[model samples]
Target chain A: MKYVDEFRDPAKAKALVKEIAALREMITPHHQTPLQLMEFCGGHTHTIFRYGIEQLLPDWIELVHGPGCPVCVLPMGRVDDCVALAERPDVLFTTFGDAMRVPGSKKSLLQAKAEGADVRMVYSPLDALQLAKKHPDRQVIFFALGFETTMPSTALTVLQAEREGIENFSLFCNHITTVPTIKAILDSPDMRIDGFLAPGHVSMVVGEQPFRFVAEHYRRPIVITGFEPLDILQSIWMLLQQMADGRCEVENQYARVVPSRGNSPGLDAIAQVFELREFFEWRGLGSIDHSGVRMRPAYAPFDAEKKFAVPKLRITDPKSCQCGEVLKGSIRPWQCKVFGNACTPESAMGALMVSSEGACAAYYNFGDLQELLQRREKEAIPA
Target chain B: MCLGIPGQVVELIDSEQMMAQVDVAGVKRPVNIACIVDEHHPPEACIGDWVLVHVGFAMSRIDAGEAARTLAILAELGDLQEEQAAMHEGAR
Candidate 1:
């Protein structure tokens, strides 16, 4: 806990809170609307709730959770395609632990596994390749899904498979990019994001150069943030300082993990294996152009999309679900009608409720402290 | 699922394959070091060096000095009167 424990120090957190307050005051009079800052990463969202960071902030500064949770944004149609591949008797489907619970149009991958499909959970793509080596007769399919953070490993695993001549292993590539998604969010009609707490992991892979447009085009300040408590608090403080200084730029608070220029070998592997798709569908957000990546033609032998006859169906978000609004920062997660009552984590009716990193799930799990604080505020008001 | 914890390299299980064992918060596990060992940047990963481990792969090598600097900034900024005031309110 050398790197972690120091980031969660209460004394440091207290100081950051004090600094954030003084900075928030500088921007308070400039705008009629609240100073809404969006943390554009689910990891940041998780840390904020886990450490009760929101409670330390003043009411004038509102933290809006963005659509950073990749699992939560995975369309039901894609899940259904995964189910289709898993149900094949000759195929052995593998995915991460959290992806098992994500519901398809009909059922989740867990449900498919329970019903006797060869759906397996793997810690990495190499493990899936190992499974393919073990079962030479069966087709091994890795349900690859994530941002630039996880892309390199999958690309390298595919490269390894090709080198070893592992004929039966392939990838169900749902790999997406972060820059286009951020652009999509910024282009949305109701976007009120004053600044951003950029995703550290993705930035570590793609670097801060990809996020220059957020500052250059949109004129919003973004601080690439770490996933620890003090990291979140310090990042929030950094964003506030930028607003106070009347400057819009991309800054790195998690400079320890993120370099100005990112991992080269990882980016090289990604360039070798994947190409941007024309448009890809997100669960809550609609089709974003050049947002998703597909396996290149050279690696077509390892592309699962061509190998299996998937039901390429487009499914809309549920009628009652306000995940789009929540993702867009137009509304808070709790304001959704189905939030706690109809769409708890146990029985997720929307995409946000499916993943722990999702805004709705984070709210359901750790947002009670803020809720209680709000309740006490309402009670204190003269009636 | 983008949880990359900083773990120290404990052992090299398969150096040719760039696979090594890293200890993350005391739990040791085998991880691929290929991504971090960029051709442009010489592979300096050795036993005892800290790397950011994400999904059984070493994403990047973490600089200890940079990590210390970040921690120092947080500590220095945390010294505030408002924070002291908030703590005093809690004491009451």
Candidate 2:
């Protein structure tokens, strides 16, 4: 906890909060609207809500939770495809624990397992590979999902499978890129984000270079942020300081873990195994070009998409779900029609309600539900 | 999951596979150190290095100097805030 406990020091957080409030005063007069800073990673959102960071901040500073949770953004069609693959008689489906509860069009992977599918929760891709090794007669498919932070691990696992001549193991690759999604968010006409807190772990693999475009092209001050409460507060302080100085630049608040140049071996493995798809569909954000990756031709033997026959269907989100608006920061989670009433974590109506890192789920689990609902009700009534 | 925890490299499990046993708090797990190891700093040199482990892989080596530097800056900021508060008291 050496790295963690130091970053969570309440005394330091209080000092940082005081500085942020002063910075807010300097920043507010320049713009008529409140300073909308989006923390583009779900991990940051989790930390923010869990620590009640939003309550501590001045009202003039609004923290818009962006769509950085990979699990939360996973399209329902993909979940259906996962179910189709899992329900297959010969396939032994393995996925991360969080992915199990994500609701598909018909049923989630958990439901599929309940109805009798060989679905297993794995800690790592290597564990899936071990399943392949153990069950020679069965096909082991690892549900590969996440952004660049997890891409290298799956890529390396594929390589390991090849090296060991394990022909039965494959990856259902759903790895996404961070930069394209950020670009999509900036390109939106309604996006009023003054700055950003970029995902830290993604930057650790991809480095600080990929985020330079946000500063140069979009003219937004983005600080690559850590997940701890202090890291987030310090990063916000850095962004506000930039605004106070009338500057737009990509800064690093999590420099201890993130290098300027990313992990070479990880990048090499990723380059060797995966190629960018033309476009990938997100649950709430729709399709963004070159946002997702698939296994290269050389790794087709280890590609589950290539090896297995999936439904490959396009399933739309429910009509009442305002996950799109919530994801875009156009509305708060509580403002969604089905938020706490119909989309509790126990029975999630949208992908955001399924994952702990998700904005809706975080709000539900950590935020005072009664207070949020009452505030929403008050806003709804005419003055 | 995108969360990466900082753990210290305890022992080398497999040099060829660039594998090492990393201790996170009290739990021990085998993690691949392929990303952190290279020609100059080989697998053997990573025995006592702290790394950010993400999903069975050591993605990056956590720099102690950088960590100390970040903390130092935060400390300085705290001192500056205290100084400003004292100045405000004097003015009042």
Candidate 3:
């Protein structure tokens, strides 16, 4: 907690908040619309809502939660494919605990486990490899899904498996790139995000270079942010400072863990093992080009998609689910019609309601539900 | 799933494998130091380095100097705010 506690100092957060409040005046004169600052990672969204960062800031600045949660953005069809792989008699499907409750077309991985699929929750891909080592007869397939932050670990695990000649272990690769997704968001017609709080951990792997387009091409100020309350506050202050000065740049506020050039070894491993798929489907956001990664041809033996026959079908989201709008930052989670009612975390209709890092789930868990609902109702009433 | 915790490398479990035992909040776990290890800072040299451990791997080394600098800046901001408040009070 050495790095964490210092970043979470209340006094420091208070000081930063005071600075941000003063910038609101400098910024308000230039822009009449409420400054839309999208925290592009679900981790940031979790921190924002947990600390009531939205309420703490002035009304002129809006923190729009973007679709950065890998688990929440996992397509329903992919979950069905995971179930298909898990249900196979000779296969043992291992996945992260966060992905257990994500609803597929038929059921989630948890429901499949209950119905006696050989599915297990693992802390790491290496753990899945261990299971493969332990059971020679069983095929251990890791349901690998995440942003660049997790890609290195999966890539390394695959490399380690190949070194040990572990033929039975494979990866159901759902690894995604952050840059393309951010591009997709920026390219959207309704994109009103004035600035961004980029993901910190992803920046640790891919570096600050990938984010330059946000600053240069889109002309938006971006700060690579950490998860702590004060890190977030300071990052907001940094973005505000850029806006007040009329500058658009990719700045690093989480330099303690992130290097400007990124981790070369991790990048090497990723390059060695994975290749970008032409396009990949997101749960709410449709297919974006080069957004997801798959094992390269050389690593096909370790690719679950090649080893197994899956449904490979596209299943649409439920009609009542407003996850797409929420993901696009067009509507808040409370504004979704099914939110807190049909889309409760207990029984989530949308993937966003499944993961704690998800905007909807964070809102559901941390936000005062009744207060938000009453406010929504008040806004709904005609004058 | 993107959660990366800062931990200090306590011991080299395997040099060839680039595995190190990292202590996070007093609880130690073996993490792969492949990303952080190099010719300059090899596995053996990473024993005392702080790293951001994500899913059984040390993805990046947390720079102690940068951490200190960030804290110092935040502290300075707090001091500046206090001075401004004192000045405003005097004017009133």
Candidate 4:
């Protein structure tokens, strides 16, 4: 709690807020365009919205969420695949807490569980292995979902499972690439971003190098920031300063962990175990070319897709769900139609509301997010 | 996708698979390295030595130059307050 609690100190957070407020005050009120800084991480999005970081900001500054939430942007078909796995007899689906409620082809893991499937939510991939050990007769498939931050844990789980000869366990890999997804956003004509609040965790693994491609090509300065309130506020200030000065380069404000080269061992482990597919389908993002990793041939025995077959599913996002637009940063959460009415934390219409880290869900449960969503119901044009 | 952090290897727990604790400003989390490629924490890795951890594996040992540079930057940020306070006093 030492490092964690100190950063959460309200006094320290307020001081940072004061600093950010001062930074905004210096800029003249009359401006051509409001500076829109794209936060390319879900953590930053949740932190900013949850803590009302915007409340502390000057009106000209705006924060746009990016494709950082692994759950929010996961295409419906993958969730449908997970639901199919959960529905199979003798198959135990192990996943993080957030994926349980994510809607998949008219059903979710939670719904599958209700219809008599063994769905267990775990905090780590190690937990899935433990579940497999406890239930030897059942096939335990860990819903391996995350960015580079979580891939090593998933990779290690397989290695350990293979080493121990655990035959009943496998993994459904949904780990994604932060840089390429960010590239997809930058490449989109809709990107009016002046700067970016880059992901803090991803930077630690791939290091500060991958982001250079983004900075160089997009010509948008990115400040890689941490998960806490102060980390986000500081990043916003740094981003604003960069935009004000017209600088486009990557800076590590979260240098306590991330570096230029990153952890080569982690990279090597993933390389040993997994390979990138030429293209994979993300529900909202469609088929992003080579955006995901799959198990290598060496680890085929442990690959969930190879080991087990879930019924091919025809899935669709709810007609009312505006998750696609929200993820694209075309519209904020409040701009979505089914935000609070059709999509509560308990009954989410899309992956955004179902994921614990998803901007909308993070707002709903942790940050009084439902109120804003409800407000949107009245504001949205009647369809 | 890199979300690796540097942690100090406390011990070679679990036989050939070393188990170590990673600290970031006194934040410590236990990580497994069976998946990472360090039969022995490279020559640079040792007890009380900082190694970069990703997904539960100690991937590589932290470089001294970069470590020093990070510490120096934090130090400079820490020094900013006193420097600014002194400047204000001189103005008064």
Candidate 5:
């Protein structure tokens, strides 16, 4: 906890809060729209709500959550495809713990398992490969997802599987790139974002170079942030400083973990095994071109998409759910019609309510007493 | 969901496989060091060195000096009287 405990020091947090309070003077009349700052990663959103960090900040600065949670962005059709793969008699579908709870078009992977499917939760893709090794007769398919932070390990697992001659192991790749997705968000006509706190873990793999467009093209300051409380506070302070100084640049607040040049071997592995898909559908964001990655042609033998016949149909989100607005930072999660009443975490009607890193679920699970009370008060008012 | 935590390397389980036992918050578990261990870098994880372990893999080595520097920057704007008291105590 050496790196973590220091970031959570209450005394330091208070000092940072004082510094942030002083930043209110920097927001002049030119900074219209209430200094809307987007924490572009779900991890930052989680940390912000978990430590009651918003309560410490001045009301002038609004921290909006972006669509960075991979699970939250996974469309219903993809979940149905995952279920299709999982239900196959010859296949053993392996996925992460949180993904098991994500509802598909019909049911979740957990429900699929209950219906006698060979679906298992794995911590790593390598664990799924071990399953293939243990049961040579079964086709082990690892459900791979996330940004650059997780792409390297999945690529490496594929390389390892091939090296070990594990023919039965394959990958159900849903890996997406963060840069294109961010660009898509920035290009949207309704975008009113002033600054950004970029995803730290993705920066660790892809480096700071990919985020330069945010500063150079869109003219928004971005500070790559860590998951800890102090890291987030400091990053916000950095973003505010850039805004005050009239400088738009991609700065690194989590430099200790994220190198400016990125991880070389991880990049090499990703390049060797995967290539960008022309377009991919996000749960709420629709289809963004070149925002996703699939196994390269050479690795077709290891691609689950090629091995299995999934339901490749696209399913629309529920009518009452306004996840698109929440994901675009246009509306708060509670402002949606079905927020607490119909889309509570216990019975989520949207992807945003399913994942812990998701904006709605994070707000529901970690909001401080005062915030929760305010939300409940709003819930009392009819939609 | 990249929830990587800092963990101290306790032992190397398989050198060829690049697997190591890491102690994270007093819980020991095996984590792969493949991503961090490059041909140029090699496996630099000693028994006590800390690494950021994410989903059963060590993503990167945590620099102790960098960690201290970040902590120092955060604590710099703290109460002046407490800083003075701490300085005075250190003088003893």
Candidate 6:
């Protein structure tokens, strides 16, 4: 209770809310309406919805979800690639538990595991290393995923495997970086982001350096926020202040966990293990040039692509699913055709509903949000 | 990607395995010391030491000096004033 109790202090929470409301009042007249802010982390998106932050906000301020869920944005082909690798004989595929239910092209990892594939859920890359040690003869493949914050762990796995001469271990690298994906989203024709609530975990590894590209070059205000309710509220206040001042800069709101240099030891472990891929495909965002890391050639023996021979396959996203539009921040989840009736969590049509962090799932699980939304819609229309 | 959470090490009691309990905002979680296992510290990493934990591993020990610096800034900024007072204070 040492760390958590202090950060979650109710008095501090009330103070942060008070601070945020004041910040909102400062920018009240700027837009003639509420400020349209986008929180660009899936974790932050989940927390906001869970805590009913949407209801707490002033009517003029809007928080749109961004494309940051690594599991949700994982391309159909990559999921299929993981499925194929899992199916291979004498192969044990490992991934974070959240990914098991994510619908790939034909089947989810959970389905493949149900069919007797050795798909083990791991909390970290180190867990996969232990699996490799246990199964000396069988090939151990860790489905590496996430933004820069997570890449260091995967990088460590590869580095440790090489250092220990673990021949049977390899990485099916789908490790994506956050900045490039943000740039791609911003560069798109539908760019209307007034401010950004940057991701905390990702910033912990990449530091505050790359994000300056979005702030300075793109002329946008961004505050890197943590996942907690108070953490997010404080960040929103900081971002709004930047907008009111007519200034744009990268600011670290989650300073307790993040520093200017970041976790250098974690950074070194990754740099030693992996390098950039020319391009990698994202689920909703398509392929961004050089946005991810593949295992370096020196670690070729530990590359799952070479070990399992998972064939290249073209997998299209569901045509009716609006996950693409939602992920691109061009449309809201409610705008999707199959949101409540058809694409409920149990019968998820896309990856967005699979993870708790998915905006759609977050919207579904928390309180009577969907019903409230319906009530509002009915009242708004003239009878 | 590795999402490292900042937690305070509660005790190094599990000194032999280089394992200890860390409190993340109040959640008591067990972490391994594979990376930062100190023999002198044993199973006891010490209570109230803030550490960066990744994937159940206590990767690095945080410096108290840095934490003091942060808290000093928060105090200097006067993080707790009435809403308007806080805004005016934060803006400066």
Best by lDDT: 2
Local accuracy of candidate 6 as per-residue lDDT tens digits, A168-249: 8888888887888888878888766778999887777777898998888998899989766777778888888897788899
User: Model 2 lDDT vs. the true structure?
Assistant: 0.84
In model 5, which residue pairs have backbone atoms overlapping below 3 Å? none
- lDDT of each residue in A168-243, candidate 2, tens digit only: 9999999999999999999988788889999999988888889999999888999999866788999999999999
Off by over 4 Å in 1: A1-7, A369-383, B39-45, B63-92
Model 6 global lDDT (CA atoms, 0 to 1): 0.72
Top-down DockQ ranking: 3, 2, 1, 5, 6, 4
Who wins the DockQ comparison?
3
Total clashing pairs for each candidate: 1, 0, 0, 10, 0, 12
**Residues B1-92 of candidate 3: C-alpha lDDT, one tens digit per residue:** 57665568999988887888877545566778999988898788998897766777888877766434433443432432332232223222
* Per-residue error (Å), model 1, residue A320: 1.2
Q: Model 3: how far is A136 from its true place, Å?
A: 1.0
Worst lDDT window (10 residues) for model 1 chain A?
A1-10
User: Residue by residue across A287-378, what tens digits does model 5's lDDT show?
Assistant: 99999999998999999998777768799888899887887777778777777778888898887898878898877776553566577577
The ten-residue window of minimal lDDT in model 2 chain A covers: A1-10
Q: On a 0 to 100 scale, what is the lDDT of residue A202 in model 4? A: 74
- 4 or 5, which is superior by DockQ? 5
lDDT at B15, model 5:
78
All candidates: CA RMSD (Å): 8.2, 9.1, 9.0, 9.7, 8.1, 9.0
Deviating ranges (above 4 Å) for candidate 6: A1-15, A23-29, A367-383, B1-48, B59-92
**Per-model DockQ:** 0.22, 0.25, 0.28, 0.12, 0.17, 0.13
True lDDT of residue A176, candidate 3? 90
Query: Once model 5 is optimally superposed onto the true structure by TM-score, how far is the C-alpha of residue A114 displaced, in angstroms?
Result: 0.9
